[model samples]
Target chain A: MKNLLIFGVGLIGGSIALKVKKDAIFDRVIGVSRHNGRSLDDFVKKGMLDEIAVNVEEAISTANFIIIATPVAQTKNILKKIYPYLNADCLVTDVGSTKSEVMLDAAESLGDKFDQFIGSHPIAGSEKHGPDAADEKLFEGKNIIITPHSQANKVQLDCLWGFWECMGGIVSSMTPSQHDEIFSTVSHLPHLLAFALVNLINKKNSKDQLLEFAASGFRDFSRIAASSPEVWRDISLANKKAIISDLTLYKKEIDVLVEFIDNSQEGNLNDYLSKASSTRSEWAEDKK
Target chain B: MKNLLIFGVGLIGGSIALKVKKDAIFDRVIGVSRHNGRSLDDFVKKGMLDEIAVNVEEAISTANFIIIATPVAQTKNILKKIYPYLNADCLVTDVGSTKSEVMLDAAESLGDKFDQFIGSHPIAGSEKHGPDAADEKLFEGKNIIITPHSQANKVQLDCLWGFWECMGGIVSSMTPSQHDEIFSTVSHLPHLLAFALVNLINKKNSKDQLLEFAASGFRDFSRIAASSPEVWRDISLANKKAIISDLTLYKKEIDVLVEFIDNSQEGNLNDYLSKASSTRSEWAEDKK
Candidate 1:
């Protein structure tokens, strides 16, 4: 893309900007954010962004591509605000974790402009946040899921796929609904469990002692519990339909396991745990 | 101590044997197992053990310090078999994952020999097992929980503490009940959640799709799910009371969190997540 405009320049946004600039893939990179701050200035100083713009319309006038790199919860409002100003030929896409809701929001706010929207999620990020945490090659050797609805433009979809490929992403395509369902199980549910687990330990009377004696297993298990609460809360609520579905399923499984343990049924418990361990081992083998 | 006899020379037992032998802390080390195997012979060849013994009574006959490194479920039977053979003034101890049950088992089988039993748990071990996986410095810079019951001999207790300290474990004493409770929250509960999480996803119709798209978060969160099913099943059952208590409380927290997400109550969800994130950060700081 010759001209690129990016909104919400945080970890994902900043990384993309830095990477594209390093690869010399874009001729002009325009940055737009809610607030002007040292971070934005640092981005410009680092040559990731050519300039920061205060006017959305002005930024859209010259752009052939736009990426909404904000939380899923903010998708619709931002789409509504920028829809009128978007260039007719420019394609718009997002980097939100949840896809179906963002697609619904795009369809609602953008109307005819919805054809330009492609919902994408790059499964590469650290628990750290902000532009300072952005890595020049964060998207290298990562998986990127592009969720396109029925109305999505074929050319734009392929173009977005190629764009991510240029940044070294292994791109895959699926329906927005399927994307949400899969992620809710693999990504969102794990975060929900970690947050609750950490909170439970903290509220216990033996909190200090528990933390003191916690070993490497505890550290690895709860590392995600230190993730940005704001980002996770937004993702959890915005994707509530998928997450709640997984959570309900998860609750049922946990209840069954608890009953087996309480009754001291060694064979049943072993069968349950063995199934999980074998599956995990199989997956790890595939990963290798 | 001299003439150490270790039963069930797996990872923990083998590691202690290697460390004590390397440090020249013991005059003789004898490994006892229920089966004759290549792994036991490998241990002898590695110099982790001076010999493998089939006669538990003959092995116990000359030992001043004996370490039972078997699973918690096997504690009572092993104690019963060795109690009659243990020499007077010789101190017997264990490396079981659960404390109170093992202590009770030691008491029941040993009878008047109860004072010779000191229950301890070294909070350092990998998921790896067997003689080949043993590390001479496994316990170095690790915490060892020494739980000696009311009837435990004072000299034996002190001697066990010093023994662990000599292997670089910073030893601390706590009631067996406290050790069970603390580990239930930090260790057992997380393992339970991981096993259930993996099983839930595996049983799903889209299991392959979910595993294919799973990310680093899923990998780290479910690493413990790859642990020994039999070992964890034993731990879960042996420490059922503490685990059930934690699981019940954990179920409640998850229910409330699920409710908040379903209703999209940003304030409540944010507050709950914030508490966990902050507590994790605080603990991480303490670790540093």
Candidate 2:
């Protein structure tokens, strides 16, 4: 029986456990979390796992596979607590938004004792969070990026990919730096923009009036601004350099657009329109 | 028997006509349009309309309700052409995004006959255009703003509201100026922002690379920018003053955010996040 133990069993880890339970690959599944542990009860109620461990050491003592799914800032501390009980052959991976910071933490805590520690991020989430919001198909058809350092072994990497595949993600691989740079623009900077716009609107002293008239445009534009402040604050600090660069680049671009709108020259309007249309059209085609 | 003459039988007009037909209200429904009039055939073949008329004068003669759903710039010319056929009692409304400009055009073209016109903007649409994309439920649970000049009668207003209610929209009355000012922020500016963002992305020489890496964030942010450029160009021009003002306001707001990020003070981050959360939470509650 292949033993699987999932740590920090919130939305991502709990979801992975649920998907893995659908198959006969794991004979025993265990979850370890620091919360009220209602998720464990819910998981059992849903038949997602066979057992729950009250502590990290007990969770990893007999596990063949371990997945750390916690906020990036919390992973390092949890890794230290579980290290003493982890087997030398226990394959390990994590689901953290920022790979570089978490990678360093993994190195410090897991060292060479663990079989492998691969960094992974599934680019799927919503404004809502928590284990109750967990969907077994959360990662299905979504992009899963894995960043394995030089020390990672092929056997462990293959097994990690097998786990992610079982969870319904289309797996891809990138270096930590590449992941940070790309997501900074595609995710982090956009969230910052939404938050900034919402703040500006609120400062107008017509927040209630504006809310009364808030249409679909404002709703969709600022949806991400409603995301958990703690998560974004951590992300904003962790990916600060890349996010700052992307934000600067976007501001400069918006300034150029402001110039064209102010001038109202038919030529500039047409130019912007054609460029925007072609770009959005191309992007629209690539959606999975 | 209410005779309904719908001009520019495109998505909005066709959908309204279909809804009215389904309710079995209008005694006669006729569609008038240009562009080879292919959409009119779909409406007639689908039994949404009783017949089609090629000329504005022919369609408007002896009609009780005239709905103008053409582009804002073209609306004036159509009104002028049909002015001779329109009776003093005939009620006129439009489905244009900008109300003030269209109202002005109607006032100029009709002079003494201007009393017949009531400017309207139904805030429901998809990026997809044409009658083929039209659905009977397009306006269900949507807001329709009716902007009437002082000359509009209560009977005419109530009848117009009744028509939209049957088509499944909550009707609200406002002045043309208010409609223009409010939508300039809520709808027009957002579309402009999306367009501008898309144009900026396209300017990147690494277009293909960006598109390949484009995730859900970029896709949703740029969705509105993918709308028809021809339609947007007219809207931007029609509501030029308000949209330009909004653009300026947005630029200033964004600049403040940029400065805050440049400073990188923790206090500033908290301020931005707090203000945004407070406003967005209120807005979200209003939406519910």
Question: For this target, which candidate reaches the highest TM-score against the unseen true structure?
Answer: 1
lDDT of 1 by residue, A1-288 (tens): 478999888889999998888887888888886653454777787787988876778788778899998766677888998788887789889998888888889999999888888889999998778788998789988899999888878889889999999888999999988998999999999988999999998888878888999887788788898998998998898788999989899989889888999999999999999999999888888887
Q: Where is the poorest 10-residue window by lDDT in model 1 chain A?
A: A33-42
**Model 2 / residue A106 / CA error / Å:** 3.3
Best by DockQ: 1
The lowest-lDDT stretch of 10 consecutive residues in candidate 1 chain B is: B33-42
lDDT of 2 at B265: 59
Query: What is the TM-score of model 1 when looking only at chain B?
Result: 0.96
Task: Give the CAPRI rating of model 1.
Answer: high
Stretches of candidate 1 above 4 Å error?
none
The lDDT of each candidate is 0.88, 0.78
Clashes of 2: 0
